[model samples]
Target chain A: GESVGLHLPTLSVQEGDNSIINCAYSNSASDYFIWYKQESGKGPQFIIDIRSNMDKRQGQRVTVLLNKTVKHLSLQIAATQPGDSAVYFCAEIRGNTGKLIFGQGTTLQVKP
Target chain B: GAGVSQTPSNKVTEKGKYVELRCDPISGHTALYWYRQSLGQGPEFLIYFQGTGAADDSGLPNDRFFAVRPEGSVSTLKIQRTERGDSAVYLCASSPARNNEQFFGPGTRLTVL
Candidate 1:
């Protein structure tokens, strides 16, 4: 989902439920994509990353899926917990420049 | 192990004042980058450095903003005649290679009053 202005698109899920956050990227040549979690007053922490070559990459409790055809990516969190609540962002890096372009973040609100 | 660290975790300055934000990237990381993140928005690229030279500064908003990586490890972002709009979280990141996973530092929250 996309956001505008001062508001971020929010997703509400129950604790222990699976959560999926979707991001539509703009760059067609982007070879690398990463998922980051940001809590209040803190910097972004890396969750997982997926290269364009693979369609799916799984971590401990997280999985990243990249659909290069439509330029879409998604992050799935298994057994979402209360501490999992935070702002999630998807960033991509182009080939020429190492600069990362970040997508509008999605706020995940895990309810107990 | 120490990750990237930034000085002046929080900075407040009057408009038109000059400010310098420092970032110490992880040792041996060759590529460093600067980004600005405003409230409710994702971080925007500001600059990138390769070694002691600026690899790309096209992301910089204007000439008033400049960054330097003096020894290819420590970097400082300088903003002259700062305006209220300059208030945002400036984040610095580093990577082992040009196209690798980047490690980010706790951003320097700059508030131009």
Candidate 2:
């Protein structure tokens, strides 16, 4: 089955440092991608999104980079803060269906 | 502006019982979604409603899982003959339209013992 997967299960980063999380997806037909942050006991929160036509999209302090050739996506967070400690997931939307297929999350541990 | 909201933040039920989870989407949002997330994984799509109709429900695991959005606002996910595997965090999200960013609520955590 086509799926999205993360490269690492846990990523430890020191406060004030930059953090990067990577995801690989198998579906070549996916046209949209999103990154979500989920804290303890809470639902996933929308972070940033990018379209397949665009290679990169930037948010406040976050950036999403997409490589369509390799079917890869990455989320970069600048100046990591303690509040950023949570599980991060990359999801791909099925064409026109708005159904998000998520990858096994990567836990971002920001150490203060 | 309020985001999505779910009822019964936590539910503990025995096996073979039935459960209904409710979702109150953001005002005027026309799209609502339901997902189930186990302990160590991401949220899995279950159903989606667009303006009082279920546009897609391909992700529903089985016939025991059902959902409705009769008024195009509040939606409910009903599960019958619940088993231990049904114990997971049920999350609801809403978007202003299709292909838009979804706002999620604090999920309802169900523990089926």
Candidate 3:
């Protein structure tokens, strides 16, 4: 069975600091990976994504690093702010299917 | 009107009852998907629809679960004889094409007591 999972269940960071969330997947065939931020009572919002062909992708203040060799993925948020506090999930897309398998979320708490 | 939307934000029913969850994808989107998320767990793929037909239904847990999208815009996920363990948040997302970026709705929180 293929599974996408996170390395931590919760992470606490102070405002003005950088935050990193890690994910390790067992599906090597998965070509695409995405990061989603989900605030309480809201749907998961797309943050950034990376393809297997590339190892890294960056958004406004977010970065996604993919290590296909070890099936590892990580999301980096710079200058973490209180507004960045949320549950973050990493999802991998299955080839040819619109299905995205989500990983156990990492709850990020940013304190000012 | 811009993003995916779900109805009845919350659902509560007794065990052995049946319930239906609705999802409205973004207009003109061709791909719709259903996912289940239990507390403290990640969302699990339930089923996927490409246009008016189901392209993949392998993630459906059992016979008690079913889904349909006749016109390919809105979809309904039906659960029959729901049990206590069937309680969870049902999430719906839509994408313009296969494997493309998807937009998710707020999700329907189902509690089977």
**What would the per-residue lDDT of candidate 2 be over residues A1-112, giving only the tens digit for each residue?**
9999899999999999999999999989888999999999998999999999999999999999999999999999999999999999999888676878899999999888
Kindly report which residue stretches of model 3 are placed more than 4 angstroms away from their true locations once superposed. Answer: none
TM-score of each: 0.94, 0.98, 0.97
The window of 10 residues in a row where model 3 chain B has the poorest summed lDDT is B1-10
Fraction of native A-B contacts kept, per candidate: 0.67, 0.85, 0.79
lDDT of 3 by residue, A35-82 (tens): 999888778899999999998988898989999999999999999999
Off by over 4 Å in 2: none
Q: Residue B75 lDDT in model 2?
A: 95
- Candidate 1 CAPRI level: medium
Q: Highest TM-score, which number?
A: 2
Q: What is the Cα-based lDDT of residue A37 in candidate 3?
A: 90
Query: What is candidate 1's TM-score against the reference?
Result: 0.94
Put down candidate 2 lDDT per residue, B4-65, tens digits, no spaces.
99998999999999999999999999999999999999999999999999999998999999
Residue-level lDDT of model 1, residues B1-113, one tens digit each, is: 89999999999999999999999999999999999999998999999999999989989999999999989999999999999999999999999989878889999999999
Q: Write the per-residue lDDT of candidate 3 for residues B7-111, one digit (tens) a residue.
A: 879999999999999999999999999999999888899999999999999999999999999998999999999999999999999999888899999999999
Model 1, span A4-48: residue lDDT tens: 111248999999999999988665767888889999988888899
